[model samples]
Target chain A: MLYNAFLQAIREIKRNMMRSALTAIGIVIGIASVIAMVNIGKGASASITQSVSKLGSNNLLILPGQTRGGPGGASSFAKPFKPNDLNVLKSSINTLEAVSPVENTSMTVVYKDQNYRTNIKGVNNDYFTVQSLEVDLGRKFEKSELRTGQSACIVGKTVVKKLFAPDENVLGQKIRLKNFSCVIVGTLVEKGANTFGGDQDDLILVPTKMFQRRISGNNNIHMITVSVKKNIPLEEAKLQIDQVLRESRHIKANDEADFTILSFTTLLDTISQITAILTVMLGAVAAISLIVGGVGIMNIMLVSVTERTREIGIRMAVGAMAADILIQFLIESVVLSALGGIVGVLLGLAITYGVAIGLDIQLILDPSITVLSLLFSMLIGVIFGISPARKAANMNPIDALRYE
Target chain B: MIKLAGITKTYGSGEVATQVLKGIDLQIEKGEFVAIMGPSGSGKSTLLNILGALDVPTEGDYSFMDTNIRGLSKDQLALFRRNILGFVFQGFNLLKKTSALANVEMPLIYQGVSAKERHKRALEVLSSVGLQERVDYDPGQLSGGEQQRVAIARAIVTRPKVLIADEPTGNLDTKRSHEIMQLITGFNREGITVVMVTHEEEMAEYASRIIRLRDGMIEKDGHHAV
Candidate 1:
């Protein structure tokens, strides 16, 4: 009996093909938007995770001043770290693998007549090791260059492109900065963009001793990069470094530390949390359309029931029970919504694929979301279809037959 | 075999109430061809609806073949209509956009007949009604007379014990009307009880018995000479 009703519903839908297509439009758009938003959000999240992890997940940053609280706070006026603090941290913490004091300043680099404004960072060879940076061409600085503070530098990929022609050999080139000229001994490999939208391969690297004496003419270090030993837990290493820095800086237990320590894991967690929230927000906004689509279905179904009053009477008069009529109409709605869901999913996937390709990110299709979307649309059909089906079922055959 | 005692049907309630069938008693025997005749608003259609089980009387004791119809639930009434009764309407009431064979197969579908049997039986009945070549044509594509033949084919497809037709030929021309009467009488001669409602006295002449109704009451009942 139900099988016959199903076929009957299909025939009705096919007979009114234009109206059926118009009615399904709302569902199609609703489902398509939901799928596209979720898929693109997932792809973006994946890209962020990859880039954050690429910045070396085990590294820690030490910045001079408390990051929180008011401007007149105790640590607000604290002095920056010096070379002595770097040595003390290295000698005190057993879990420390390598530490490098880094100082940076924005300046212009000129090779011949071409010049570009870029950041110049000064650090020892340990900075490259701690950051997992590799030299793509030429070699690292010799010990004498670090000790005597020689005017030697390694340029990043962005600097090389800006300061030299494609055919020019960058290793033996001389780039002038401020009033001093430095020989480029190496060029670091490319590391693409970071999560913060900054290009990681757009800087020049020089020995810390050279930068402090020749450029800034100061002994203060702006920041310090530290790497924990392979087997040591990051939290344990953080605690040890925090305790040692407090003690060496002569800060009492009751006083707050003058510096802040940030671990890579903490940064990764914060970034992931933010992206997850954004994904959910976008998905929710897209779901509103789905609900609206359901309402559209209900509206059309109500109109359909009213239009087919006499047809219902005919079926009832021919011995069709109320249940049969109800089932037939309900089946029609379910099939319509289910068809919309299928088309929406396919369209969403196609749009997501196109966006991933355009943005140069990995395609992420969450299977669970796909299945849930299909199920939810069908649920919309049933939830909205009940009233109309009941109206059709409860009609009096005599009155219906008499209806002109 | 059918019996009706004091059947009364009223529309609405309170001061607006209008009684359509008032205190009517009638009996119909198996294989009897009866035509109910009346003027407009005389309740002949109401009486046919009550006999078809399409509507329940306001007050009545109705029985067919020993089964009390008033005591049956809505689903049970529907089952009774499916198994023991067939209805033909004035407008020919064939499903729109449906083939003639499919229209005739509708009652059998509710009877839970298998597809193969339904197809074979529908084809056989369509041929019996002289619509064998028009089996696949929809009602819109067939002439009015052909459409009436399809309705008749649908009415008798289930081989019901009783066929209730309300003005089955009311929309046809004189020639088509006589042809339809001839087809219906042919079925009545084969032992199927038929009760039809019509206002035309000439159409009533084809029935073996004629019952005239006036003011919701029976005015006359007698047999017609062949």
Candidate 2:
């Protein structure tokens, strides 16, 4: 019975092909936007994870202020950490692999005829080990150079490219900073763009003592990077670091520690949560359009019922049950929306493809979502189709036949 | 085999009440062609609707082959019409934009007939109505006579016990009306009971029994040998 209804529905749709296609455009756009929004959101979030993990997932960052709002920002007026906190964390945390104090400042470096702006990092060799970085063409800082505050520096690949010719031999070459000059003792290897698309190889590294004496003119360390051992869980290391930092900073028991401790995994979780919420929000907006599309279908279906009253009357006179009439109209709407779903899927994939390339993100097509959208479109038809179908089915045959 | 006892159909209530079929008691035997003739408001169409099980009489026991139609549910009444009766309208009410064969095949679709068998039966019935070559033609593409022929073919395709036609030739000219009457007569000869309502005297003569209605009651009923 349903199969025959489907056949009748197809014929009816074909009879009014133009009107049917036009009526389905609403569902097409609704499903299409839904698919595009979800897929693009997923691709962007996954891209973030990929880029962030590239910076080494086992590392934890300790900033000397509370994360005032969320994971990213810090309180600007908080006191800076001294080297004492770093020693305490190293002694207290058994899961520790390596730790390095990090101080940074951005300034322009000048080489004869060229000048380029870049960030300079103040750290020891432990910073490279924690970040899994290799200075492919350079040597590490000497113990005396690190301890005595000598004007020695290691330049990143970008700084080298901006300051000197491709093969001009950067070692022992002096580059001028804002108010002083430093001799480059090594040049670091190239690492590409980070997750947020900022260049990873765009900074110079100087010994911590020289950076404090010649640049910062203070003993304050702004941040610290800690790497956990391969088999260590981050929570255990974080607990010890928190304890040590709290004690060294003289925070009383039961008081909120005025420092923020962040791990790469925690940051990834926060970012994932943010992306999921964004996806749901975008999906909700798309769903509203779908509902509007459903309303459009209902409107058209009600009009169709009115227009086909005589037809319904004829079928009723020729041995059709009211259920038969109901099924016929219901099938018509389902067929219409399912067709829209198919077209929407193709259009959505086209949009996703175009935007993925344009935004330089990953292209991820979730097969289940495709199938779900198709089913959802059909469901929209049924949900919105019942009223009109009932109207057609409950028609008085005599009055219907007499309808002009 | 149709019977109607004390059938009363009234529209509205209170001061606006108008009874269409009042105290109608009629019986139609199998293989009989009965014509109902009356002026407008004589309740002829309402009586036909009751006979066809399209509407329930406000007060009546409508028994078709010993089954009470008034006792049937809405779907059951639809099934009663589907199984035992067929209808041909004055308008030729062949489903618009549908081919003659498909229109003829419609009743069998509800009867649960298989597609191939229904196709075969529709073609055979259309050919019997002298529309074999025009089976693929839609209602708009056919002349008045041809469209009525398709409607008749649809009415008889299910092999219904009674074929109910309400002014089957009202839209046709004299010659086309005669042609459609002859077609209905042919189906009656083949043992299908036909109940028709018409206003024309000439059309009434074609039926073996002619019943005339005045107001809501039968004024005269005459039966003759075919």
Candidate 3:
């Protein structure tokens, strides 16, 4: 009986091809948006985790800030740490393997007439080892160059691509940094992009001494990054560093510290929480469309029942039970919604793939969500289709037969 | 066999009440070809609806082969109609846009007949109605007479115990009306009890008995030599 009803319902839908397809569009858009939002959110979360791991989980960033690492706190105009603080933390903290005092600037580099604006980050050679970087060609800065404050720098992969030819011998080449020129000591390996889609290889690295003496001409340190010993607990390292920095900076024991330290774990957690919230918010908005789609189905179904009144009357007179009519309408609505859901899933995946490639994030399609979306669409049909099906089923055959 | 005792059907209630059929008591034996003739508002349609189990009488005892039909639930009435009665209408109520064979196969689908069996029986019935070549033709694609023939084929496909037709030739021309009446007569000759409603005397002459209803009452009922 159900099989026969299903066949009849399909035929009925096919008879009014344009109306049925138009009705299904609401469901298609709803499901498609849900799939696209959820999958993209998941892909971004995965990409964040991947880049965080690549940047080294044992890494800790010490920013000159107070309270949380939010925009206001991180970019606070507090007293920047001096080179003395970096020296103190290096000597006192036994758990720290290496610490780099970062003095950063965005400066224009010139080589003959070819010029490009890029970030100029100044640090010691220890920063490269702590960050697990390698010189792809030539060599890193020599010990004498660090002590003498020489103008020798290593150009990262992006700077090399922007400033020189691919096969050009870049070693010993001098590139002007605004006033003074710096000789390229090496070419850094490609680091690609980070989680926030920042170009990691798009900067030139110089010694902190040369940067302080020639570029900024000051002793203030903008940021400091340290790598903890492998066997040491990260929390203990943070507390030790926190205590030393407080004592070195002469803040009282009861006073709030004037610095903030961020670990990779905390960054990952914050990003993960944000992505999860975004997914739920977007999915919820998409779900509202699903309800609207269901209402559309109901509207069309009510019209269909009225339009086929004589058909229902004829079927009843030919021995169809009321339950038969109900099942037939119910099946028709479900089939319509399911077809829409299928198309939505495909469209969503296509959009996701395109966005993933464009934005350079991972593409992750959750299987359970795909199945859930399909079931939810079918449920929408059942919920919205009940009244109309009952209307058709409970119709008086005499009146229906006589309906013009 | 069919029997109705004191059947009355009233529409609405109180001061607005309109009585369509008033105390109709009738009987028909096995293999009887009966024709009911009446003017408009004579309640012939109402009587046919009660006989077909499409509507319950307002106050009456209706029994088919000694089984009471008045107390049967709506579903039970449907089963009774499915198992024992067939209906053809003046409008030629074959589903629009459906092929002739598919229309004929509809009643058997409700009967739970297998696909192969339904096809075979639908084919045989369509051929019996001389519509074998038009089995794939839709109602919109067929003439008035051809559509009526398809309807007749559908009604008889289930081998119903009684064929109930309401104004079977009301929408057809004289030539098509005779053609349809001849088909009904042939089905009746096959020993299936035929109960038909018609306003045309020529169609009435095709039956072995003629019952005339006037103002919801039977004015005359007896065997008429055809």
Candidate 4:
């Protein structure tokens, strides 16, 4: 009996082939977009975590701001920290591993006869260790080179590629930056673009003393990065630095601090939380589309019940139980939904792959999620198909037979 | 054998109450051929529907082979209809999209007969109705006479004990009507009691007895002039 009913359901679906196909299209597109968006979100999240992990977790950045607990709290875009304040923190903190006061300058670099606009950063040798950077060629600046403020520099991989051809050696070459000439002593390893859509390998690095004296002629540093010992807890290290900076700057008790210290791990957590919330909001929007598709299925099933009223009457007249009619309609709805799901999976994967290539991100498809979404669509069919099927099954055979 | 005592059927309610059948008492012995005849609204169709168990009288005791039928549930009546009786309608009532063979096999399927057995029995009955060559043709492709023949084949496919037809020749010409009446008579001769309704006296002559109704009551009951 079940087999016959199943065959009948399939035959009925085939009888209205065009309408059935159109009805399934809605579910297919809805499910496809959901899968593509979810997978892209997952891949983007993984890439972000990996990139943040590359920056040492023990690293922290401190920037000068307005003193808190005055009339108003500190504003984020206020003046930056000065080099003297960084020196005081470096000399006073005992648990600190290294400190680098960083200043940025944009200049047209002249290598031989070719010149290009590049970002130049001035920092001591400790900046490499604090940022967890490795040199691919030559070596980091010598301690004497930083103290004496020599005109020596390390070039990023992008500058190296632009100024020098692949076959030629760029190490030990001289590049002119603004008012002075500097010799390249090493090349930094290739670090790809950062989250803010900037290439990490498009900058030149020189000693802080050289930049303060020769290039910018300024005492203020744009940023200060502090590296703490591995054994020290991050929060404890932050508190100790805060106290030392307060005393060095001569701030009284019950006074707000004069600077903001931010740990890399905390920043990572904040960014990840924001992205997760966005992903959930977007997923909810996709779910609404699926609901719309479910309603479409219900509408079509209702029409189908009306169209087959005579068949229903005949079946009931010949001794089929009411539940049998209900089951047949329910099975047809599920079959339509499942077929839509299968086609939707393929479409979503194709879209994801295309977008991943176009935007250059990873395509990470989770099988568990795909299966769950497919099952959820089938559940939607059953949930939505029941009322219409019951309505059809409950029809009086006498009235149904009389229907034209 | 089937018996009806004080059967009454009415439609609507209150001031517009219209009775379709009233105080109908009738009987048919096993293997007997019977016909019911009346003009439009004379209640012949309503009586036939009640006698076939397709409907229930508003007030009546309907007994089929000594079992009270009016008290049977819809599902029980459906089972009773499938196992012991068959129906032939004026419209032929074959599923339009299916073959004559499949239509003939449908009642047996409801009886839960296996596919091989159903196919064998449907083939046998189709041949008995002279539709052996048209068994695989859909009802839409067949002529009116052939379609009615297929309906007869389906009605007798399960070897039902009683065959009830409502206006079996209402849609056919004289020759086809004669052919259909002949088929019903042959089944009756084979020990399946036949109850048929017709307005034509020629068709009524084939039955062993005739019951005429008027104003929702039986006006005459006797053998036709065959």
Give per-model TM-scores: 0.94, 0.96, 0.90, 0.87
* Stretches > 4 Å off in candidate 3: A69-72, A82-85, A92-94, A107-118, A136-204, A209-218, A230-233, A246-255
Clash list (residue pairs), candidate 1: none
lDDT of 4 by residue, A53-143 (tens): 6777888877666534331344646565665677778887777898998788799999887888999899987898897777999999998
Q: List-wise, what DockQ does each model earn?
A: 0.72, 0.82, 0.75, 0.47
In model 3, pairs of residues that clash are none
TM-score of chain A of 4: 0.85
Q: What does candidate 1 score in Cα RMSD to the true structure?
A: 2.8
How well is each residue in B91-156 modelled by candidate 2, as lDDT tens digits? Answer: 888888888888899889899999999999999999999999999998899999999999898888
Tens digits of per-residue lDDT for model 3 on A357-404? 999899999988889999999999899999999999999888889988
- The CAPRI-style docking tier of model 3 reads medium
lDDT of 1 by residue, A131-154 (tens): 889999998888999888899999
Model 1 misplacement above 4 A = A66-79, A136-138, A147-150, A165-174, A190-198, A252-256
Better of 1 and 3 by lDDT: 3
Q: Which ten residues in a row have the lowest lDDT in candidate 2 chain B?
A: B77-86
True contacts reproduced, candidate 3: 0.81
**TM-score sort, best first:** 2, 1, 3, 4
Summarize candidate 4's per-residue lDDT along B49-118 as a digit string, tens digits: 7877667889979998889999998777778877888888888877878999989998887788999999
Looking at model 2, residue A6 earns an lDDT score of 90
- In candidate 2, stretches whose alpha carbon ends up further than 4 angstroms from where it belongs are A90-94
Give the whole-model CA lDDT for all candidates, comma-separated: 0.88, 0.89, 0.91, 0.84
